[model samples]
Target: MSISFAFLLKHIRPFGTSGYDTFCSVDLANFLIGNLGLTLGDIRVLYTAWRGVALSDAQSAAIIDCAKDVANARWGQLQQTTGSTVMFLSGIQLQDLSNASLGQSFTWRPASKIAVAVRIDGGHGGHHARWDVEGFSGNTDSQGAICHFSDLV
Candidate 1:
C-alpha cells in the first residue's frame, strides 16, 4: 500500500524546527499526490548541504547554482512522469533566518515556486530548510508557486 502524504509528513517532522517548513513540504507533497494523483512510492526526497565550503562569492554562486540545477532536474523528471513535482531542502542551513532569501533568488519555470525558512537552535544544532513545487500546465509548462509553512512542522 502507498503511504499517505500526511503520514510521510508526520514521519519527517522531527527533522525540522519550524512549522512553516514542515507545512510547505507536506502541502506540496499533498498537492503532488492529490492533484497529480501520483503514488507516494513514486516520490523521492533528496537532502543536500554545503557546510565545509569556503565563504566566498564564487563558492556561494557555485553552491546556489548547483542547488538550483538539482531542484530543476528533480522537478523536470517528475513533470515527465506525473506532470508535477515537489522538492524539500533540509539541513544545517536552516538555522539562520536569512537563509530564506536564497529561495527568492532561485529560479522556477512556468509558475514553479519555492518555500523556505530557517530553523534556529538556541542551544541545539541548527539547519536550513526549504520546499519547492513545480506543476506542469497542459502544454507541459510549469504552473503556480506556493510556499507553505508545513515544510518544517
Candidate 2:
C-alpha cells in the first residue's frame, strides 16, 4: 500500500560568503493530518540536506546544532496532533557547495545554482491528488524550484 504525503519548508536562508549560516525547521504533523488525512502516529519524519559551504569548525557545529533544533521543533509541533507518531528517519545526504556561490547576493549565474529533489510516496489511492507546496532550488530566482511528488509502480 502507498500513502501520499504533503509538506513545506518554512524558513530557509540563502547561502552567504561572510561565513554566515542559517537553519530552518518545518512542522510535518499538520501536513500529514490535515492534508494527507493521516495521524501523526502513522507517519514518519525524514530530514535531508545537501551540505553547503563549510566555513570553520565552529561554524559546522553551529549549523548542526541549528538543524537539530529545527528538527526537534518540528517534532514537537507534530506531537500536538492527536494520535501521531514522529518517526525520525536516517540516511541524510550532504552535498558540498564550497566552490559555488550559494548564499551570496549577486546577479544570476548558472554556475552557482543547486537543486534539491523530494520524493513522496503515494500509495494506490486510485485517484490523482492535488499538491500545492513550496520549496527552494538552485534556480529559485529565475525559474523557481518546487517540491515534486510522484508514484512509482
Candidate 3:
C-alpha cells in the first residue's frame, strides 16, 4: 500500500510543541518510502521512529542535516531493518497564512487549508500549526489539516 502526502495530511495530527522532527520524520519517512523503495516493514520501522526522541537544540539544523545525510549510508540505522530518516527544509520558506483557519484548541478539521506555525523561538513551526492541534488529545483525526500548496515542497 502507498501512503500519499494527501493521506498523511488528512490523517495525522500535529505533535504538541510544534517540533520540526515530528513533522519532518513523518514526511521524511513517507518521502523515503517513495524515493528509496523501502519495504512495508521498513516503513513501519520508520514511522515508529517518529516522535521517539528529541533531536532539537540551537544547532538542530546541523543535527537534522547530519541525520538526513548519514541515514542514507546504510539501511539499518534504527534497528535490524529500520533505517533512520531525517527531514530538512527544502529552502522554500514562505510565511503565507492566506489559507489557514484552524482554531486554538481543537482537533477537528476545517474546510480551509492548513498552515504550520513556527515559533519565533524554541521548537519549530510550519504553516500556522499552533492552533491546529495544540489542545488535541487524539492521536489521529478522521480528517486533518490540509498541507498548503506552498508547503508542498
Number of the candidate with higher TM-score, 1 or 2 = 2
lDDT of 1: 0.31
Model 2 agreement with the true structure over 1-153: per-residue lDDT tens digits: 111222223222223323122221223446646775766555433222322422323234334443344444545565422111111111121112212343322222233232211121223212221112222232122222212212211
In the range 1-153, model 1's lDDT, one tens digit per residue, is 222343223122212334224334555556767876766664443221222111223223433333344344444444322211222223332222222222322332322232332332223323333434231111111221223222222
- Which of 1 and 3 is the better model by lDDT? 3
TM-score of each: 0.24, 0.25, 0.25
TM-score between model 3 and native: 0.25
- Which sections of candidate 1 miss by over 4 Å? 1-16, 44-66, 70-153
**lDDT values, one for every candidate:** 0.31, 0.28, 0.33
Pairs with backbone N, CA or C atoms under 3 Å apart (clashes), candidate 3? 115-127, 115-128, 116-126, 116-127, 116-128, 117-125, 117-126, 117-128, 117-129, 118-125
Question: For all the candidates, what are their Cα RMSDs to the real structure?
Answer: 14.9, 15.3, 13.6
Q: Name the 10 consecutive residues with the lowest summed lDDT in model 2.
A: 85-94
lDDT of residue 51 for candidate 1:
24
Order the candidate numbers by TM-score, best to worst.
3, 2, 1
TM-score of 1: 0.24
